[model samples]
Target: MASEQMPPVVTLHEEYGCGAREIGERVAASLGVEYVGRAMKSETIDEIAGDADEGGFVERFLRSFTPIPSHDANIAWALEAHADHEVADQNNRYLADLAQDGAVIHGRAGAHVLADRPATLHVKLIAPLSTRITRAATEAGITPERARHRQAREDRVRTDFCRRLYRWDPRENDRFDLVVNTASFTPEQAADLIVTTYRLHFPV
Candidate 1:
């Protein structure tokens, strides 16, 4: 018999506090695939950029862009750009390796990184800013104001990261094959939609 082909990779991008980790886990479990999330990607990137000096390519490139604690707008922009590029490259490689086995990857620009891959389904999850703030506040046992501040900061970072690295605005629905509004759909519902969509595109 011929070898079984791998399933299509499901890549999910979500706004801060959108429950991506929970939904991603559900999708991975429902599909019996690996769940690759930002935590894992961060660990991988730290390892990749390890104690190597500024002489190492990755280290040198990363160090060259460190933002100075000054009010220089141009310097800050360059710093953010460089940091975004470093992250994008590391994440792209990590996702590329995971793509071989087929996995549900959330965040770390998995969708953008695997955009050209035929066997990848890109999904985006979002919710109203207020809804996200409330959910985050409840989850973290914090004040709504604090949650709102945190969410805003995270959203800004992610927006800049994607714009700098991919020249794409992740909030735009056109970037994803499927966009789920978490306020309207439960995590389970979102996961089911993603699984169903992936299967529709690449049936057994």
Candidate 2:
């Protein structure tokens, strides 16, 4: 286990199609820390270690975050408060543990999970909806219409996930230490900005 004394951590929350994964990877590379994506994946942790509730929570949480095609366009996931809290507690501990050695965590409400931790930088990446739709379409090689649909579904899901677990809105700028408008910045530029911001906030 890494020591309880943590190094600086960067937690990134982004709107759909905002290039968070790409920028987060770059930031982690620059910082020389682990880039944690889908850390909620079953392969990373035991899927059946606890009671029926724990096992069920893991399955539902995974399904809630699965890629777009598997989800219904019209239906939003209805997560239970009890299960959501269990998952939130688990996520908090796991993220804290990962940050002990420094990490850049993408999505999974990381900003909210580690909001109170010292030496943590919480960033939100977003762009205009129109810009995001275009970027998402171009990146996925999908039609604009399909991209818009997926974007709406994903954005809603992430927002609702935070509301359910943390009672906070992820889109609020006040919740983040820095909010980057990706419409004005490329992934490389955005990564550079975040790294610079982190250094400024916690100078070596």
Global lDDT of each candidate: 0.73, 0.75
* Top candidate (TM-score): 2
10 residues in a row with least lDDT, candidate 1: 53-62
After superposition, the stretches of candidate 1 with alpha carbons farther than 4 Å from their true spots are 1-4, 39-86
**Residue 109 displacement in candidate 2 (angstroms):** 1.5
lDDT of 1 by residue, 90-185 (tens): 767888899887899887677777887776788988899888888877877888986776675566655665666678788787758888899998
TM-score of 1: 0.75
Shift in Å, residue 95, candidate 1: 1.0
Each prediction's TM-score versus the true structure:
0.75, 0.76
Per-model RMSD to reference: 7.5, 8.8
Q: Write the per-residue lDDT of candidate 2 for residues 1-204, one digit (tens) a residue.
A: 222245768999888788887899999999889999854322222343233333244345544544224345344333343455667788888887897889999877788778878778999888999998998888878889978866755666557667767788887877699999999998999999999999888777
